[model samples]
Target: MSGLNIISNTSLTMFILIGIPGLEDANFWIAFLLCFVYLMAILGNCTIVFIIKMESSLHEPMYFFLAMLAALDILLVNSVIPKMLGIFWFDAREISFNACLVQMFCIHSISAMESTILVAMAFDRYVAICNPLRHKSILTSSIVAKIGLVAVIRGAAIMAPLPCLIKRLPYCRATVLSHSYCLHQDVMNFSCADISVNIIYGLIIIISAMGLDSLLIFLSYFLILRAVLRLSWEVRLKAFSTCISHICVVLIFYIPFIGLAMVHRFGKRSSPIIAIVMANVYLLVPPVLNPMVYGIKTKQIRQSIMKAFHRNATRPELFH
Candidate 1:
């Protein structure tokens, strides 16, 4: 069959989402587990944001960036997990083309923002540790707010063209997506039209946006390390400890992210299960763990959480 004929014949109005390949029989179990994780992620991230906002002590740039991270985690998981539950539990597997594009935009653009936030957090740490006296002067509330605005604008600019690019393509192959959500790579893979430009643009965005962010983060940490080594032994330990949570969060996000990227770009012959697992790990685990890490490792956040819980417990119920 000619490509044009195939394109004309196939209905690409809606894409089918198969939640987790090879786990169709265990969808009930999967749905339950996913739901639990989703709730925990939402609760944890919300608490973090709420605490950071309510506590005047956490008005510093570091906490400011941390709050941004928590909020992004909420958005990141929300874009996928609810729909996933609908697929697994309700068997609502269909997503309209426009809806799929929106999902793809949310997933990728929010991911880019998360990376930028991480880099900003790294810079916050760098300034705090390396230039303690200048930290306050350098990263004022105005500067941090500007950074947040830049993250949003940059993410939107980079991902804005992707949906249009994919929309212009003619999808002639199977419309069934690889995961519970739509991904640009998966959606474009089914297109009958030549997607070399799309593929190239995608790579450019990844390399220029996320890749550059990674480099800046690494450089910030390197400077931080150098500055710490020059400090007293106890002070050195304190500086390293301050960065532990951010480091853990970064690893949590980037490790699975890299795995999924590799699976998409290079693992065409790899198992569908591998891709799906990587995608889930990349999207879900960070949201679940980021707040937990910050809550346990950052003393102020922990105290705020305890205070909130105690306050709620001490309050009388209106039903009484």
Candidate 2:
């Protein structure tokens, strides 16, 4: 209460993200690695989007959802990593309170959107494999558009109030955040004001958005597996091949997320660097791995990429 009064008297205008504690001297090295990762993620996802757009053969429901996922990855990581690179490379760690809220909203909203998109993709796979005859009829372009709209609405509606809730709190400490981004819990931890409401809202958002989406994704796969079991071995294998890339991307996205959650809940006494690293990995790994997974695992995407390259190479020869 006394802390609340003090914080109220002294309003907070900015926060300093404590990026990679105990690695002060090694920031440049870390930034170099981070820069490489950012480049890979941006380039890889954009390449997927471009190929999907260019190749008419890829104009299907699954690739439609994939393009959305790629776009989400670009927006999600772009929301945090550039400024993070700024902190690591140039010592630009100060973030205004208003900007911090906006960043928090973007990160959380895009994350929720990504989870939703994953679920939509799982449904797409389910319809394609289990009810191949009805796939196109069910997942028509309009239906896909509606799914995208629902994903956007779900993410935006759930995460919209979080920043406002955090803003209402009075921050008593130095306004320092653990990670290099303005995560909801990280920012909330700085507040001297009562945070029961903030915590509750955050839990609601997680359960409603990510938790529910993950469960639905698993259930979809369960149904998919059951459907596959009834088919001949060769057909089962072929059906399963289409799922390998999605499963890999899911693991890449969720494993680090679970690790970060575990560390936050149980690793209170552990080194801060562990949490920071987990946060970084959670944000960085999926975008970098997704395009690689899809490009390598899915024949269509690989062919499209090679076809585009071949077309580009031949245009010059034709001119000659």
Worst 10 residues of 1 by lDDT: 1-10
Candidate 2: which stretches are off by over 4 Å?
Answer: 1-5
Model 2 lDDT tens row, 222-315: 9999999999999999999999889888888888987887887689899888998899888888999999999999999999999999899889
- lDDT for every model? 0.90, 0.88
Error of 1 at 53 (Å): 1.1
Candidate 2 RMSD to the correct structure: 1.5
Best by lDDT: 1
What overall lDDT, based on C-alpha atoms, would model 1 receive against the true structure? 0.90
lDDT score for residue 300 of model 1: 89
Name model 1 segments beyond 4 Å from true: 1-5, 8-11, 317-320
Best by TM-score: 2
| Alpha carbon deviation, residue 314, candidate 1 (Å) | 3.1
